[model samples]
Target chain A: MVAAGPNRIDPYLIPALDGVAYGLLVFVAASGLVFCFGVANILNLAHGMLYAIGGYTAAALLDGGWASLALALAVGVLAAAAAGVLLAGLLTPVATGNHLTQALLTFGVALAGGSLLVAGFGPDDPRVRVPAALDGSVVVAGHRYAAYRLVFIVVAAVISAALYLVVRRTRAGMLVRAAVDDPEMVACMGVSPTRIRAGVLAAAGALAGAAGVLGAPIIGPGTDTADTVLLLSLVVVVLGGLGSMAGTLLAALAIGEIQTLGVALLPSAAPFLLFAAMAAVLAVRARGLATRWRTT
Target chain B: MRNEVIRWGRGGVAALVLVGLVVAPWVVDDYTTAILARTLALALVGVSVALLTGVAGMPTLGQTAPYAAGAYACAVLGSRISDVGVVQVAVAAGAGAALAALTVPLVVHARGVIVLMITLAVGELVVTVLGRWRSVTGGTDGLAGIPAVRPFWGLPVLATDQARYLYTLVVAATLVGAVLLLLRTRAGLLLRAGRDDETRLRASGHRVPLLVSGAHVAAGAIAGAAGSLLVVAQQYISPADFGFDTSALLLLGVVIGGTASVGGALVGAALVIAARDWLFGVLPGHAPLVLGALFVATVYLLPSGVDRARLRPRPTDVPPVHPDRPAVREHAGAAPELRT
Candidate 1:
């Protein structure tokens, strides 16, 4: 394989880049789920709607001016974050091991959010255009691809790096870890779990929201996108073992490859292919590695 | 003695409610009657969730898979055999119960979030098969042109919306009543005891897994019967009809109405369906957001559920007061172990 040299390497770079970029996007979308589910033991089924809301918000603002992408993106993240806060506030008192209430409540929220998007966006599919600067294609090693994709890949890297730093280095990160490890002890130390939980949920919502804006051009905003996005995120979170960031990153990359490569290999059952892998994973690792993260 | 008396009183109230439902289609307009009929069909699904979540203490998000199985079974059977509504319902219920039996054994050992994950995976599996299996499930296009179900044999039953409404109401009420009666049995007490705590029940000499799996099977049948009725009502069966949203909607109905009560489940289902229809029609695209907000609101406002008071039989003169179950509300001195 090493002897194949640059000639062989050239052929695989595009697929590899696509896989990595998609993987990073998954990380952004699922990291929030990891925090809420992994640490707080709260199952927020409506998490995907945060991303959907963000994408629609960005799509709406994109029409005003291309220069407004930054503001639109910010607004989208904030709106979704607000939604997260609302959800956390509403569910904090009632969430329990029953799972029925949590699942139903979140499902309702997802439906409601999706409907609201349809009402505002007029039930038509919407797309965000690539920034003019990164719209064109570039040739590298005799391969031509969208220049914007490479930019997206780079942006994803920066976000992931920042996330690592914040989680590893910040005081808030310590509290989060402690809360997940032992919520009572954290509470006994005068740390308000409610505030911590709300903050985490809000941040996760913002992250999902940002991912929506970033991924809108690629996936587009459609009627079923919310469900599709959520399923993918759930797959990623499960694959990564629920609460582990490193696990999420690794699983996202793997699943992204499975999606792209599975499509390349078997186009007919491409969608079913992802879940097929999930079933296999679940089968092999019964109850999943994240069982430890289950707070209850 | 007090608990027994309360139970008997609640039973009487339930019977009264049943009579009221039986008469609804006769008095209401065709549109309202049809809507109520649809509500009853959906209510059966809610009852299935109540069986698992409320009584059995196993919250399953994937009841719709069995529900879809029943629907598809009815669709296929009705297509090939008689289109009599009763026969179609039987086939649907049997298929649903079988599917539930098959799935429950795998994850009944697990609890809480694990149960949720397992059921979700099962649901996705069903949907995938329905979408891709093509031959039996009709792939994504779904089984279409499901013939209308006749009320009886040789007699041309009125196919008007009002008559169909009455038929569905009767079927739904009968099914709901049967489930309620089942819950009142000795076996139902065992199931509820298992919900409170499974370890203690095991010590009490009850076979926990059998009860758990039994609940799963029964819930599955209820869901399936509801799905079958839905196929008859709509005269169509699509994979979309049995998707996650449908499952979620049923669950929402159960929780909003309250748990562990047939009346609560039916009321919740009616409210959820009516809300969805009215909201979707009036707001035009805001159905999901409204439902989502309601889900959050219901959980926040009533952790125990809207009919928390009805969970325990209250004095007729003074209305029951609903209270939040802050700490675990398992009976004192004998915490019912939630195990299987």
Candidate 2:
């Protein structure tokens, strides 16, 4: 392992940087899922489609300029938020149902929505055009990395800080925490649980939409993009111990590194790495994690 | 009198279905027969899904891992080791069970949706490995041109669609019957009890985790055997056959069948698989739309999943049967039921 010495470290520097950006991308995408699941207790399987909504919006609307980027973000967030509202409406009838029913309903929505998207966009991976300013790669540690990817580090940091502030410092955040802790009590307090559910989903959708737009260049808009993002987000949510923001960020970053740096380091085991890491982390965190979530 | 009449009616329906299955290959066209054969394999996978999801109280979309394991194991070893269907089925079952056992720790710790996510990972892992292990799985295009299988030693190799369909039907029926019989045993009772209340089951000196693990392994074996049937039925195998869509369809089929009913799962799975094939053939690009719409509709129509009251009453919180109080249990006997 030490045979390659300091030269080995130089080649891995780019993937490590990419890992940070990728990890943050995952954290941004997954926090929405964490929000929905934690606050609303609804496993919105259509969460992926919401992200895809943003991705396809980016693909169709972006024409390689700052104005286009701003336009894409606004439209993407609005569109995804609207879709989230629609999902909440669909979920009303089965709102009190079991996980199986909820999962089935949302999964159905994802399937139907994803297909409709393909039909609309045509069954092909759409090209994502970055803004002119971020079009080229930047050299880092004598290696080149996409400038757009590096942008996620700054963008995601701002998003996370803003999210933390909103959740920690605001009345809405307190209500959300209360809803997660005890919805029946929240209902008793005259705050309609329905409104709360809708609001949480909308906010979650907005987060996913933003992630989709920004992460499009790296992950891109495609037939497979929704599923890939959904799977990674799911892994992050689980490994993050369900609802803790800090845990999710850590998990996402770890996954990003595993996906990038780990793969670079152990090229032969690339296929097995993502899930293998998931299984290993899950196993180690097994009973402790399960019981902890139950109490929460 | 009503219960007696219902039992007789159910038996009559079973007889009719059995006779119909026996006569199907003769009545159907070759193309339809082949599809039916493949559907039978999938229906068998649905049975396993139901076993875990409905009976074991572990919602899962991961049976495809074991199913793929069994299918690949059979595909790779069938020619070199043995082409006899029974031999391959055993090999496949072992592979599936082993995979399930290895994964039991990751699974048994959690309940409900967590299990679903974990199993999904297991399935995705297998698919990823299968896709990359190109030398073995032939990559994404899948392993094709697997030879026709023999049902048993000294039996003729199944060549025609009619022969393959009949073989699949018989094997599926046997495995399903075995599952039905198993559910009528003490193990089944413990499994049901564990699902209903793990705390109570544990209090009653039952090992809930062990029961979950056993049911998981048993279901994996059942799924594995189904995988072998798939290879024979299609004479071709691909990763697409075991995709997330397949798992979703199978799980929904189990729900349609009433989660606790083995017979329901098999019938429900068969109906779903046939529906997909028919939909694809008839509607082209609209297959997913139709199926997805059906899922949404089903959720609204049958929230608790197809008349569980009729198939198996939600067993009320019966006091745990203490080991020494077999006499008391006899009087309160919910007794092992054959839902099939």
Candidate 3:
């Protein structure tokens, strides 16, 4: 892929780094979906609304200053969590319904939530301003990269590591894993599956919200941001295989790379590349890249 | 004599409905006729969804793929061919069916959720391709300047909104009637059985995948025809016309009208179209909030749809039991004893 460049850095390296950052952001957005679908068995189609809310909150509140940016991010995450709780409450009645009903209900919520955002923020594209500290360029391997993007990579990596530890090591994580494997068995063991599910939904909502705030600078929050994020997350979850964390991470990173590289190489065909890759993956593994855990 | 009377009564009702549709545009304003035409197109799509999700028990969000394919086919062919006639619609339907045939392997034999996702992916992919193929699809601007639709057999072209409305109404009603008739056939019964329990259908030696694929193809064709009708009605086609939102709206209409009922699809489509048209006119940007809330309420309160009121279960409406199925018999026998 390298053309002519002895002293100059390979052009692909920047896009690759950009891809890593984008992949990490996707992982953050999709991680919650993986948890909710795996453990709670609820595919929250409205998860993107939470991300949009977070982004909007940040965009509206951030004054481009460092302190305000931090505060805005915090507030945005909290707002997203609240939205999540509201979604969970709304879905509680229909949780027992078939997947189709659940999907429809969540879709309704998404529609309403999206419109509400439009109403509150207006239809104008609102973007979050990067903090002053992360505003300039930084040298990476002799190549200058956006400081905000590098910071994003570090922050997302930290979040991913923490999330991995929590899901793999903690008692709550153990409960989540058990519930995912078999909710009925966990219920029989004395834990209320509904409560666990609600908690997971809330946590997943928070993660989506955080991703929204963090990703707003890179992706830019707009009227259709929720739909775009939702589609990407769906791709990530499906490509990773439903309810598989490792699969989501890997799939997210690969998709992030494909998206960036495709845009760089073939701008016109960029959008289809992610989907074409997904179609190829699904063709090979009909169930996705990874299979779900089977108790039997 | 009784069967003859019942059939005559049904035929009379059908004839009356057709007469009313033909005469509707004359009484109503052009705006109302345009709205009615839009409603008819949407209703066709709703029927397609009901056929797959309601009758066949496969909830799909991929109908937009064929719908867009049909519209794009019309936009491309109609623009090139100078004279757009009924034959163009047929070609559009073929395009839709071809897309459905391509997607059959991905959707058929998959689990319910997986099927939904795969179909959704297909729909998204179609939209993406359309948006990227700038030369043909015109990218985001979409294809415009489609010729006015001409009726078959050297008939006068539908130049006015009223004529288009009448045309859409006739096509939609025919498709609805065809779907209703299809539901009465053995294949329809097999679809319903597959919906209720695919395993049982498979055990009974039916090819469940093939059955599902057939229903999908039929739905795709219907949606394709609807898309062509939409283009005829508006004389414009865009990628945004057949996006995920439209798919969701169609599904919502199917659910609101009552799944598995032909009449329900019509009622649901009307409600959706009216709400979209009127509410957007009245509230502008706030229509989505209202529509969204209405959808959630409908799903929560009217799970079966507005047609539920007319379809109350009668005391004699008992589920049929297969006498040859020993497993079913054993389960039926043990159920009451365990309760007792």
Work out the TM-score per prediction: 0.86, 0.92, 0.89
| Model 3 stretches astray by more than 4 angstroms | A1-9, A95-97, A287-296, B1-21, B82-84, B304-340
> Per-prediction interface RMSD?
7.3, 5.2, 7.4
Candidate 2 lDDT:
0.82
Question: Which lDDT value does model 1 have at A35?
Answer: 88
Ranking by lDDT: 2, 3, 1
Question: Clash pairs of candidate 3?
Answer: none
Model 1 docking tier (incorrect/acceptable/medium/high): acceptable
**Tens digit of per-residue lDDT, candidate 2, span B300-331:** 87764542311111223454333532221211
Structure candidate 2, residue pairs in collision? none
DockQ for every prediction shown: 0.42, 0.39, 0.36
State the weakest 10-residue window (summed lDDT) of model 2 chain A: A287-296
Scoring the B chain of model 1 against the true B chain gives a TM-score of 0.83
Work out candidate 1's RMSD over C-alphas. 6.5
Model 1 CA deviation exceeding 4 Å by range: A1-17, A63-67, A91-112, A140-143, A276-296, B1-16, B151-158, B306-340
Comparing to the true complex, what docking class would candidate 2 get? acceptable
lDDT of 3 by residue, A1-296 (tens): 44466533467778889999999999999998888777777767888888898889878987779888778778888888888778778778763525556666787888899998988887999857888888899998778999999999999999999999998999998889888777788899999866886788889889998998888887777888888888899889878877777889999998898888667877877777787666655655653322332220
Best of the two (2, 3) by DockQ:
2
